[model samples]
Target: MHIKVKFLAYFRDLFQSREKIIALPEGARLRQLLGSLCDSAERHKAVFGKEESLSPHIVIMKNGVPVQNSGGLDAALENGDVIAIFPFIGGG
Candidate 1:
């Protein structure tokens, strides 16, 4: 399966691209896709916390819907699915 990942805001610089297409095995879950994206230790630490959970500072969406609404890291992924990642923005 192929997933289209979009990096927004500072994530574009962190990932070194605005977007990327990742190929994964059939039935891959969101967690696997996230693991693939973190190709280095620094990248891994940036996206995941000590417990391997997504950092609270980041937000992820699948096909325009927040991942949390779909099932989070365990969310099932299908071919052609689009995933968008961005830092959680806050304002006063």
Candidate 2:
């Protein structure tokens, strides 16, 4: 499946590319996309942070709302889904 992915904040800086069309397997989730992105980029370390650890504050939205646990990135993705990857914001 193909989807539109937008990186924000640190992730965007790491990617060096604001947006791109990524191709994934039939079923792909937010988490899986992160993994793939990291794998495909040299600066992935800066975007994903600690190895094997998903940033707790990282926010991933599908269409418009938060991904329901994103099924841990194993979520099924459909064609043309706009994935907005944003950093968790704090107002304290």
lDDT of 2 by residue, 1-92 (tens): 89999888877776767898999887666667777777664545444556655556677788876774556455668889988777788786
TM-scores across all candidates? Answer: 0.92, 0.73
- Model 1: which residue pairs collide? none
Winning model by lDDT: 1
lDDT of 1 by residue, 1-92 (tens): 89999999988888999999999999999999999899998788878976988888889999999887678889999999999999889799
Model 2's alpha-carbon lDDT is 0.72
Candidate 2 clashes between residue pairs 3 or more apart in a chain or in different chains? 31-73
Candidate 2, superposed: residue stretches over 4 Å from native: 40-53, 68-70, 90-92
